[model samples]
Target: MTLMLCSVAAAASAHAGELPRLRTEDGRHALLVDGKPYLMLGAQVHNSSNYPSVLPQVWPVMQALSANTIEIPVAWEQFEPTEGRFDYSWVDTLLAQARKNDMRVVLLWFGSWKNGDSTYTPEWVKSDTKRFPRLQKRDGRPTTTLSPLGEATLAADRKAFVALMRHLREVDREHTVIMVQVENEIGSHGVARDYSPAAERLFAQQVPEDIRRASGKQSGTWAEVFGKEADQAFAAWTYARFVQEVAVAGKAEKNLPLYTNAAVFDATGTAMAAQVASGGPNWNVLPIWKTAAPALDLIGPDLYLPLEKTYLGLLDRYARPDNALFVPETSNAIWAVRFFWAALGRGAIGWAPFGMDATSYSNYPLGARKLDPATIEAFAAPYRLFRPIARDWAAIASKHPTWGTAKNSAGEDSTSMGSWKISVTYGRNNFDIPWPGMEPPPWAKEPVGGGVVAQLGPNEFLVAGQYSRFQFMPVDPAVNGQIMSAEEGTFIDGRWQASRRWNGDQISYGFNFNEQPALLRVKLSTY
Candidate 1:
């Protein structure tokens, strides 16, 4: 705080080894400085209101995590509240501070959308709906939507957004802000995807071939690609329409990496996501987003679902040759490895938990409205594990096209985690106990313990569960070829540090009943 923060013409990290020079190459995403694979261990502090002031205070926490990139939001309300008014001073403050801190920024436009709510609308247009417009529901009611039919909303959104892109272009072409999310959660709550008569008219019509050409399909209507899978009849048109309109505006500005976020829908049926929308995007309608927003590089997931099954489904949805998977928002704390592993195994470019900035987050559990404390504690473990491996993973993914496709280099399933493993089938196997616990349930068969596992480097990993004493064995020569150990610590004052060690053939940390998870920085030493 006392010293003048140095700035990178393109990007800079305050301290040596504080952050890495990051870039994505080919069709893969990785963080590299001169040219070595790096994984991006990042956190998104969705703090828009407290920009310049909070940035200096907030960045030290990120730098302590050894975080490579910082994902911050530049709200539309602040940037452009009026038709021609554009204020980028906050962005200037943000970038300059980030450069000083030696951190990179991934800007989120809290414009036309943010959790599907237009809460960021500026004072001028927000007060006047007649000139701006709102989307109508089936009952001819105004559904808290920025009218998809409103040209003023579109113009306001585009102008501010274009200004943002232009600013980032001139200031960030060095790619300091390596990528940008066009809008926060596009359809997390826009129910029925705008039933406005104008929206309806566009929805009923066949999708233009230009969209099809953009998406990569040679032929077929919206329903044809996704099928009336979920009223495929109207959704394809609506979702495509929404994506196309936004994408055109963004690409029309700058081609810097662009993406949109979607909330996950129920996998059981094609029914609209009950908590949010009827016509909003689910897994089935991605092709339309791809086609309609060709210039838009990816349609990311804003995951809140706790179930691992749904995460696998979501990963399959966004993981594509052309589309790299990145989660803009996900559950704060939970056994999120199922999702993280899925993203890495399937070649996701980037991922982060939303609202990570506030310490109050620890007390809130999930989002402002949702509380799932166990889920939060479960996920907080991985945040530390990623610090050392962040750049390495990204570099590997970028260098290795097969990076995302290879679920396991050594054959581990992507979905397994420690806490769930103990509850799942641990008491059933005959394998001897490494940690404490006599197994569970009278119906329990043998002695087997299952926990969560993540491979950071060749042999290095972080593994934990309902507390375990793992007796590891080598099945292959590679497994036996290296000396292994891990650093055990939690995020204390923003840095990942080791409190103790679990030495010898097998090491263990954490108690069996606390519900708290232990993370290890597994070091696989070749020398």
Candidate 2:
């Protein structure tokens, strides 16, 4: 039983609040602390939840990200393998260490969902099929599911969770665990929806109007919920109900935030349609889940898509005022730099690139393939000062997505990472500020500061690295601050180039530049 104090002196000194809340400011949503928007720049460690021994090594990575909170899972099998046997040493240790690091956390309940399977069921429940129901495949063979209707299984899960929640109230009533994910990537596989006897009976009955009405959905039977495929949405609705029950039990004791993560396939009506109609958190069924799981506060998407534009676009679609923008997981790549910058600039609550382990070999998802040396360098730039960099950047990203967003030209006419499918765009000269640098891994360039850095106003910004200077030029008098002179350049793709240089170092005083990253010290005054 240790304390987890998650705040930096610069940010924490002014705020006095027990817990954090999400808020909207200047047209962006940010996590509010002490009634002010707080940014969360974080990363998801690789298998950090299952292995405590890896913590020492894994924690370093989390520290590097400057993460305000960690998303860790407590599996049912690991905690209570045998019927009533419950062990919390791993979690306790994690909590204690989190306190040591002054970090906050969001716990994922690995009860019935972890990648859409009951793989973490305790041995008692795993072995005893009589008490726990299983999902059925199209052919009627049992699919993976702990009977949504199983009295014993649900009772066991509820009790274990309630106990866990009660203990949290006793030990962490201070709100160390700000939020809890009801389950991880909850959705059925190899099966559209549960077709078990109990599940089947529930589906056959009349539609739960509370659900239909909540959705304002054109309703009839499961068949009419959509058209011909309403049954799938119906089945997903039923499973949601199951998860909602477990969530209700845990949230009853402590009123901390609660949410669920959806393993996104695509945004086109078709992709999400399958998950929804087949018993997933499709947008349509959102109204359904809202009704069923009133206790759950948010629903998020875990993205690993190669399509950068589309992937981020999906995040934008789901990121609503009622639903905060939280990217639970993503692949670690160079573009992540831009994405992270954009997400923060847009007011994202959290952003994590998966595989936060020490394994240098790299184990990102399939969609995250094709990392050239340049991309590697781009990603490396932050790792040199992970925690400091992430924290500093995350503060702005989480609080002001619009703030972190800046449009600068590439330094060279053309620059491409060796194997990357993408390119860095810049103006002309390959200067550090305006130009996207040649791939320099975070591990390569030693960082001197504690947190990450980014530009804010014209010439104003906070730095996490030491003794580094960047170059830039004035474009729109509105954003470009006062410069010594003009430096003509154009960005090809993602790289930049400086063709001509004008003498402005004489007048580059702190006039026009207010909070810009590149124009630090040099003022960008309004002409």
Candidate 3:
């Protein structure tokens, strides 16, 4: 993956010549923007924070967080307030703000579905249920969820999305908007699948041929084909098909990468998967979505589960040979940084924390809504540390093996990747300089330190971590190796700018990585 920078004046030229594309190398994925490999150190604004007035706060918070890109909504109701008369003012403002701030934008389309509810639909559509009906529960009662079976709703959403793409082409000649999320957490909340008359008729009929072929099943009805999982599978196919139509229409206007994010359901039964948000592309139903929605460039997970296993498990599941890994939304908790590194190690194209501003709006996940200074720093630390070297890292991270780990107080931790074994130790005193009778500092007790290591060559490595100790050794004991040189430096525009040489006591025991983040170029020799 190469990094290509589009000049400010003729940004349209880059898109015209070669638009942003997702490529896979050695079963890993990379997103190339303007022809260059790009890493998105991103943050997502609150659902209602994309308004003109609220965006003032959003930009400052993005700057404070040191984010290179932001995810903001372009609501259907806001864009098409009336029936046909469209307003591009909000989108125009968002693009302008992003350009002024020198940041990229991922526009989320809150059309038809926003967190399992059609509340964001235009008032005109919501008022007339007959024209644009809502999903029905098993009892035949209308729920807030939009009915994907409704042609009116699908047509309205497709028209609005296509308009957005067309307008984006006109104004975003610089290609400031890199990607578009088709819808927000699409699915039914109270029910597994819509029980509307149209939905029932289709469900009772033979299961779709494409879905059966994709799942490798013989001809059968929905219930007979999927048995106990019939309802969820039925809903997934309908929802995916609906999103594909909207995405196809938009891509026709401006062919940018398009994806939809799922409100993740636990594969383990520790949490109820049905209650989480059914009908969307949950892990189990991912194949159905893939076969049904071929137009979708990718399917991402909005990981809000706070558990370590769950977060890492989502990364493992989504980073498949066919699908690229991208976390479009997650909480703003300090622990999120650890998952960021984990995602990188797993070859994720990008990851962003949801509701990253200092303010809160509505009842969107508390961890994401209200941001504290510590939380901002927790996320910003990596972004600021990686900004200069991000392009180079993105180019090489997927090709070469990489590994990451958080500070584990339980005991010593280590990760072996490529040709080196990296041993990580917690709560270490200042060993960079000799201090007789010195004790470990207070910050060492519960220090927040984790990092990512990417092998650049057989004997050369790139290392960055904070608040821990890193010792590099040969993975194979038979390969006698010693550290040849360790230069603490920074990458300025893909060039190495070394400032300090580590010898004598500095790297005698191991690198005493502290709160201050630093990038290191280490070389080793096998004797």
Q: Can you tell me which runs of candidate 1 are displaced by over 4 Å?
A: 1-38, 47-50, 188-190, 209-254, 278-280, 337-339, 359-389, 399-527
Tens-digit lDDT track of model 3 for 1-527: 11232232134335453667787878877887876677888899888887888887788889988898899999999999998989998888888888899998999999999998898989999999999988888889998877999998999999999999999887787788888999999878768888878889999999888899988878999999988888888888999999999998999999999999988857455224455578888887888999989888889998876666677778788988888888999887765676786787777788998887655553334363447777788888888887766666777775777777666546367887667788987777756456788787665665266777878777888788877788988888988879898999876555577899888887887877776777888898876
Output the better candidate (1/3) by TM-score. 3
TM-score top scorer: 3
Number of the top lDDT candidate: 3
Question: Please, what is the whole-model Cα lDDT of each candidate in the order they appear?
Answer: 0.55, 0.56, 0.81
Q: Order the candidates by lDDT, highest first.
A: 3, 2, 1
Each candidate structure's TM-score, on Cα atoms with residue i matched to residue i, is 0.69, 0.72, 0.92
User: Which whole-number lDDT from 0 to 100 does residue 383 have in model 3?
Assistant: 85
Error of 2 at 418 (Å): 39
Better of 2 and 3 by lDDT: 3
Q: How close is candidate 3 to the true structure, as a TM-score?
A: 0.92
